[model samples]
Target: MPMEIRLVRIDDRLIHGQVATVWAKVTKVNRILVVSDDVAKDILRKTLLKQASPPGVIVNVITIDKMISIFNDPKFNDFKSMLLFTSPRDARRVVEGGVKLDTINIGGMSFSDGKKMITNAVAVNSEDIEDLKYLNEQGIKLEIRKVVADNKVYMMDLLKKEKMI
Candidate 1:
């Protein structure tokens, strides 16, 4: 089926309990691909993420370019992967790189310097807003939810409420 992308989630804290247990079960993904340049470069972090994954599910940490490469390769068609990104900017880059994404789940973005809180679990800076806006412009549905059981909140609605859009 050409490597089904079960879900594309943006969570600063990747591969957490909710992701490992809930999302993994809901999506029925055999592989969890963490596409982050920083995490892929950090050996300790890479190993930790792998260790954090749920049993029976393989986890791979790789750069965005590598993801695009394997995604386009025929040999990788056997995987049903759930892609994890740390930021909307990285997700946007992958989208621009020609990976078709219909939707992106904004799992969590903790409060950081110069960022405004949109939701308790989500915060955004000007750069984040721009990247998110770009993704929205590409006709991708952006939703915010900490877990599968949580009600889906449309990201643009929150942005509009915050007057960021």
Candidate 2:
């Protein structure tokens, strides 16, 4: 079977209200893979996050290490999985570790000190900007978009303006 994955969105708040309410329904995704080392280590947190997901959706919280192991396995490619990551560092780690994917959709990365605000909903620090540029150089599409309906913001454009890339 040809497996399909949609909306590889990077949001700090993983599997939350917006994800469950908007992105999940819009993408018609059946599986959600949250790639986070923190969640993977904590059994209680993983259980809570799993419970937060809607009834029909199969949610899996896996560490970067575990994700790499699974991604290397051909059998893992059989399922339609939407990959979610918390930060650009994690995303870069996954890519650097050889997790292949075409595009990465950026959603809500909140504003923090030392991070330049991309938009009201999105922000980027020097590290994240560099990561985005690196991903772009790797021929991966880096799009900063809030939702399916929002306009696509290219990482290259953001880099040029911010001079971070």
Report per-prediction Cα RMSD to one decimal.
0.8, 2.0
Candidate 2: deviation at residue 141, Å? 1.0
**Over 4 Å off in model 2, which ranges?**
1-4
Error (Å) of candidate 1 at residue 43 is 0.3
Residue-level lDDT of model 1, residues 19-113, one tens digit each, is 99999999999999999999999999999999998988999999999988888788888789999999999999998888889999999998989
Clashing pairs in 2: none
The alpha-carbon lDDT assigned to residue 75 of candidate 2 equals: 74
TM per model?
A: 0.98, 0.88
* Model 1 lowest lDDT segment of ten: 67-76
* CA lDDT for candidate 1: 0.93
| Superposition error at 12 for model 2 (Å) | 0.3
Cα lDDT tens digits for candidate 2, 65-99: 88777876767666567889988888888889887
Write out the backbone clash pairs for model 1.
none
